[model samples]
Target: MAWIFALTIDPVAADSADADFADTFAVIDPAAPALSVGELSTQRGDGIFESIGVVDGHAQEVTAHLERLAHSARICDLPAPHLGQWRQAVEMAAAASGPGESVIKLILSRGVEHGPAPTAWVTVATASDFTAVRRDGIRVVTLDRGYALDVPARAPWLLLGAKTLSYAVNMAAIREAKRRGADDAIFTTSDGFVLEAPTASLILRRGDTFVTPAPNGGILHGTTQLSLFAHLEQRGYATAYETVPVADLSTADAAWLVSSVRLAAPITAVDRAAMPVDAELTASINEYLLSPRD
Candidate 1:
């Protein structure tokens, strides 16, 4: 399906009647062209963004995503975001997105050259179909991130934990995985510890305990994974955060990639080596992820 990029910069100017606006809607457009050629986000990838899963016209974990975005901005030394403005914009787009599954993106960057404030926008678009992959599972391969697990501690300037817009390396890793006939890529440290996927967190099931790499291991603290763990713990399942090695992927009882948009997708194979998995457990976790907390 063709994607509609509806560029509107001012939240107050959202036009709900446009023909190409069904799948995508923008709540803000500042300039006549939306974005300028000199935007730092375009020129230097100097921005932070959050992708939220929208179901039934409600954004899942909006507060969590916004908190992460703020953290990313602080790490990048960008100005603080106007939370009120962002929330309003997101709500506007979400309301116009209809009662279907959609993806909401909150993007903020250092303002365009000579501009006074930050450049921010909220976009709502149709989410991709993940039924087959979510049900059947995926094949994955490990790739070296070329950074030690402790690099984030020693080099804060690297922004290892920040979800900046500079995702070229992450995209390249996934491409290399596809080139090798795999569905996704998991990044391993220079010393051979599992980090995370390009766009999701890794969850390894060892018997009853759910093990995920610590954020200190150079990965994002995934909101979806945290929520799932909370649900599991409330229901008497064990959880842990520790250093996980790539070899563990081969011996784990089950594994999954959890994120906001994809939720919990089982990993059937790692490095072309088939791994044992519990389909019932996978489905149960997915159900919890999709369940309403309130």
Candidate 2:
């Protein structure tokens, strides 16, 4: 959280598409040639990955990071990567990446030597800029479903906590939002419980406390959102978990679409309704980020 500021992916990068990293690397997808990791194979299936923030040449929250890495691997049943070398992979990509502050992504596919596997994978992605909806605030639309409010309580066997690469559904929602003249889709369950954004967490503020749909709402344990909450708690802002509906989101005093990339991005509009993007909430987030990290 201390690593973020405003509704931005920090500073923008010089270019996004062909952004370079400090180190020589392999851009591997099953459809193309991948960097050789000592014959790790490139013929098998798919895998899952993460995209973490890189600030001042350091990966923010490295501990929660590795845990996420493992979480994804477990989700897809891929073998765990070598810790030391894999971490260096992130550092290598960060160093070799393009100009200005950046966010990095690492794609790790389960290449070759397998029976029944995922098609391919991306381990991580890092870049300074994010595909946020706007500059001042975001314009989001409510999704068709509600938060899976019973994930933890009802279906403990589900991949509720895992980060999966099967993102076609989420991608479709973004397109749908665009069709509706909105930025991104906020997914919910059928019963209408607000869960998360296209790729971020939904953080809404009540009177004083910042509330988010509980993890049981069927949201991934957002690395950025949680880390930011840690900092906010230290700053005396109570962060509570609650079941939020789209109607409630449209009326919050302040709200932001948060994630590891865009630290605390404000949401100016939810669907067609306009809402206030509280200055105090923004200030609190900035103060939290610019402060200090544990």
Candidate 3:
């Protein structure tokens, strides 16, 4: 089952001190038509979005996701999202979720051409059971992302750092990975630096230290990764953000791809080369992820 809500927003009044949000949204029938054919999100993928993991009706890492949404808006030049209104929408979506795992997505799109404001909505739906992949782990292959590590610094207009609606390349990379006999793909810069997985963030574990690629290199900062790092740190594990070289992947003691909905999936193999997996640690990490979190 799924639920959708169309948000009523006034772009010009986005930052107004007296902006009203009491009736800012309305529930919509998922099967019925809600968006226009001229919507930029569908036509040109001109927008930004964030997916929040929901466990037992509780939306996790909402603050982090909202922050990223605003960041994307600034990058895309879309109207700044009213965080308070979006938070209410999240609460409403979470309330509609079942007791099991689910996903809540928030989308703010460039509305119809020459339209007054942007198009925004929230959707809640049941998530697929990822027990097997999360437990047994996934096979991964590295793919070049066709840009140097300095692309974000050099080409800000590419919108590489923003979590925009444009995902053709991302989906194609995953398809290419599958064709190469792998479950997923980890993107690497043309200069041979590790970036991130198509839909997840990469975390490499070396001894007791945990490292993820720095977000400065056009990486969408992972909310789950941040939360897990906090959990790991509280448990006495050192964490750092650094520019990870592709060669470092093979030498890592362990690795996992972390994301919002999928949580943490240990990488069993990269480029068909076997990587170590710590089952006990993976289970513990997933346990913490499955719990209700703010």
Candidate 4:
């Protein structure tokens, strides 16, 4: 899901590789350092991918991850790859995977336009450490350029709802945020309607109400975001799906960027202003995730 090169790695399993990937696509060694995306495979056509966390040798909610991939792919109009092949590849990579935590990414591509069949696959590796995300929280930089949210779902025209391989804008936004001394970026319409974050689902707390952008926000439907909100209702947290103004978040009790990877990254700073995470809200979320559900 993320590729900012790699740092230190601590392995606890026999299958752990030397670094993350000596110089390949996946992580064989977390310490080998990051090579340029020049190595990113281009032989495949555009497709979708899923980032999954494997715990206790079991991939948590794998079906949900796969379902999301399928949804994204279908909307993007990208060629769908065989799920069985992807399963095998992920398992092989996991077998050779490092210890501790591993991020299993399933990347499906149509393969270089050599033929009709799309080439797709999955890669596994030790996920990079997000000490910054875990500690300092997220800094959201609003970008001027924002695409309009296509009201009615257009599975064909509006591939924006899908997680396509063509993420030039998404990646650039994050890079631009860092350049502005912010942790991440979120897009806003020229008219100033706040949209989703580059890599997460936008969320905010107004008074006691936990609110997130409506599905019509036209952003990728995040499983983690949906899961968190679904759990909130059962745990006594009030949540609603609605349109949120960019400025409204500045005065909100708490703001968050949710995703499978970040889980719920607090928006500590927005373009310089700060809004710390609500301690009580954080506790409630942790309790929900750690506790079992029916």
Q: Which stretches of candidate 2 lie over 4 Å from their true place?
A: 1-32, 35-45, 113-135, 146-148, 151-158, 283-294
Per-candidate Cα lDDT values, in order, are 0.79, 0.61, 0.90, 0.63
Candidate 3 accuracy as lDDT:
0.90
- Superposed on all Cα atoms, model 4 deviates from the true structure by an RMSD in Å of 8.0
When 3 and 4 are scored with lDDT, the better candidate is: 3
Say what the RMSD of model 2 is: 9.1
State, as a TM-score between 0 and 1, how close model 2 is to the true structure: 0.74
Q: Worst lDDT window (10 residues) for model 3?
A: 4-13
What does candidate 1's lDDT look like per residue over 117-208, in tens digits? Answer: 67777666788888777789989999999988889999999989888999999899999999999999999999989999999999998888
lDDT of 3 by residue, 182-237 (tens): 99999999999999999999999999999999999999999999999999999999
lDDT of 1 at 266: 92
- Arranged by lDDT with the best first, the candidates are 3, 1, 4, 2
Superposition TM-score, candidate 1 onto the true structure: 0.89
The sequence of per-residue lDDT tens digits that candidate 4 reaches over residues 1-294 is 333222211112223333333222333343453332322235222656677665434454565666777787677665444344344445555565555445667765654454544444455556656545654577788996545555435444746667777777888999999999998988886666777887788878877678887767566777777778777777677988877777786888888887665566778888888886876576556445433221
- Each prediction's TM-score versus the true structure: 0.89, 0.74, 0.96, 0.76
In TM-score terms, which candidate is top?
A: 3
Error of 2 at 11 (Å): 33
Residue 267's C-alpha lDDT in candidate 1? 92
Q: Regarding lDDT, does 1 or 4 come out ahead?
A: 1
